[model samples]
Target chain A: MKFSRKTLGIPYGVFLTLFVVAPMIVLFYYAFTNGQGVFTLRNLTDFFTDPNTLGTLFYSLAIALTTTVVCLLIAYPVAYILATSKLKAKSVIIMIFVTPMWINFSLRITALKEILTLIEGNLAYYPFLNSVLGMTYDFLPFMILPIYNTIVKLDHSLTEAARDLGANERGAFLKVTVPLSLPGVVSGISMVFLPAMTNYVVLDMLYNSTYIMGSLIGSYFAAYNWHGGSMIALVLLGIICVFTLLTDSGEDDARTGGALL
Target chain B: MKKFRRILVPVLVLLFLYVPILMLALYSFTDSTQIGAIRSFTFKNYETLFTTDELRSMIVGTLLLALGSAVLATLLGTLGAVGAFYSKKRTSSIMSTVNQIPVINADVVTGFSLCILLVVVFGIPKDTYIPLVIGHVTLCAPFVYLSVIPKLKQMDPALYEAALDLGAKPRTALMKVVIPQILSGMVTGFMLAITLSLDDYFIATYTKPATFDTISTYVVNATKGSQTDIKTALWALSTLIFVLVIVLVLVMNLNSKKREQKEAKA
Candidate 1:
């Protein structure tokens, strides 16, 4: 008996339907309905109107934006150095930066919390700083890996050609290398930005704070307020969708280079 | 000065990355109740880590789940990639986009929504491992798909056709020819899935059985409570995990490097 190639996808299709598609539908349903299960736009209106929710949303955005910028600033130069260097063991160095990810993140954060306590008397005082530091520490490798992969695969001759045309090293890098590596930079931004927005773990472990979107949804669910949690999740999903669309373009090449494990 | 700056910048960044892990490693050896203050040096933490039933069970459970879900995720992910690679353009595109939803979505949202769908709506009990395993597979399968798709794209399309033309059944061709070409990808995907499952906190928090705790969930709860022995023991656990990871990554890198050299020679 012949099995069509398309039929091989049947299990995955069913899995996606049951898990991915159904959960989303359920989220939308819960977001739109109240405890009585009657459909209402109150959740939406409440999200926009409630100052607490709105504050948390804006605060989470600010944190995510700050974390993304810091990660990029720190990661770009490191990625650039590692990728462009003639050192034979650069792969080992890159592994050093990335292997930290393998240690359980909670443990890493706990370790960070300890170091911070040593540096500063109480962590509660420097919540924002610690949060940013924790995030930058955790997500920097992600930013580094993509940018390194992209820069490593970059056309070296383009920069050399720019140099041949009388462009200085800085000019050549700015014009050739920078432009070509934008896909990596953009992907790194998306990778860091989206997760930073929702990774309340960093905040929670570092400072016991719960003002972010992730903890907000978690709190709602913990309190049995699925409606509010779903609403926040829907809003977060919308933000991620828009961010992804804006950043979407030729990521296949950048992604194909890195092993990511 | 310029060369020195490049070296210095990377060195400092690497230092920043390693400081926390180094601190954990250092503390694991000391008989300190907290991270900062160090007293006498001892191996009590390691002893506690190995001996405690709670810690042992949690560690074992987490590893078992990671391996189990990774196997399931690899299967689904490989099938999806293979199927999509061979299917019509529209079908493949749809499959890719659907797969991306879970990948791009936040974990908190995925966990909450899955909890609602399976536990609340579908009437699956929270205590059962069904929700937890399904949640992990859902979390991981998309990544597997991503990793495997590249291998499918890299494989020569003619090879599968050639096998079929040689009178091999489609199943046999896929199993014998196509599968071998993509096995490396499947292995990478499996490893990735395991790490992701091990690292996950939010999804497990929502979908896991009431009594069960993965390392992430356990650490979070344990740190909140005042069990100094368990808390200090976790530092030892962290050191052990860090060492294990270093060894695994070094071995994998060396193996890959060897493979590349062999390919070059060939």
Candidate 2:
């Protein structure tokens, strides 16, 4: 039997529609409807009006932003070193960065928690710091990989040209290397920021606090308050969609040039 | 001094990365069940992990779910890539854009949305295993799709035409010409799907039925209420996985190096 390559996508198309598009619609439907299945904006409005809910959203954003910034600062130098180094086994070095992820994620966090508890013994009391450290630890690899990809692809002559034109080494690095690697920086930021906001597992394990948006949504769902959960999730989806568009619209070509891994 | 700084930076970063892991590895052999205190060293936790039914099942469940979803995702994604390769520009573009949603979308939203779809719209019983599988597939297929498409694009388009011109059937041409060219990408996609599925806690927790427990969910739940000691066993598991990953990475690097040397000589 001959299979038409054109028709090959039909099954995935159907699957995508049923599983991907339809589920998002279900979330929206639940977001708009109350327990009685009647149309109401109460869930959305109540979420916005409630200080605690608003607080969690803001806190989540703040924590995720901090994590992204910290990851960038730490990863940029390491990635720069990896990319520009004359090492023959650089891919092996990159693999070392990625290998940590092969261990179970939550278990890694659990281990980190144990180490922190040993050192400070008060991370339980300091939720914010604990969560930030955990987030940075988990997301640092994500930041490094993309920036490393971009740096590896960067033309060395650009920096050389800058130096020839009388710019100093630091200046060339700042103006040439940093600016050219912006796409990877952007991808890394998004990779870290997006997940950091939604990862309640780290928050739960490290701080046992439900102060972040992820924990709030999780608790609502756990309590069978589907409407409330769906509403928050919808808002999160909207925020992320807008965020992605803002970050990616201008950098599409440059990013596709760099390997995402 | 310059060379020292270069080596020192990498050394420090690697140490930062591994110290906690090393601590966990050390504690994995400890006889203590308490979370904060480590007293004696023993292999009891490792032994307990093998004997414990719940722990053993969690490991098996996580692996099977990852493997199963990786296989399904790779198959569907390969088909989708080929289909999109041949599709009209507008349709392919739309599919590609839609594909990015799962990659960038927050796991919570994706998980919650799927949960709503399964429990609310379809009225699928919550305890059934089907939703977990479906949810994992949805999570994984996009990664495979993304990885495979580049490989498909990189292929010489005329290879397919030549196969067809030689009087081969479309399926024969695809299996012989197209599949081999994209096999590396498919393998990469399969591995990616497995890793993504393996590390997934949010989606698994949301969609998994009451009867099933993945390693992620099991680990999280283990620490939830009163069972902190179960963590020592989890430490043993992490150490085992970490060591295995190191070995795997080394083997892969060696294989690639050998292949590269052979190609150079050839």
Best candidate according to DockQ: 1
lDDT of 1 by residue, A227-258 (tens): 98899999999998899889997544344334
DockQ, structure candidate 1: 0.76
True contacts kept of each: 0.79, 0.73
| Two-chain DockQ for each candidate model | 0.76, 0.66
Q: Which digits, one per residue and each the tens of the lDDT, describe model 1 over residues B1-266?
A: 99998999999998898888888899899989866785889999999999999999999999999999999999999998988888899988999989988887999999999999999899899787999999999999988998889889899999999999999998899999999999988988898899899999999999999899999999988878888999999999999999999999989889989999999999
How does each model score on lDDT? 0.90, 0.84
Q: Ten consecutive residues with minimal summed lDDT in candidate 1 chain A? A: A250-259
Candidate 2 pairs with clashing backbones: none
* Every model: Cα RMSD to truth: 1.4, 2.1
Query: Which number leads on TM-score?
Result: 1
Winning candidate number (lDDT): 1
TM-score of the second chain, cand. 1: 0.97
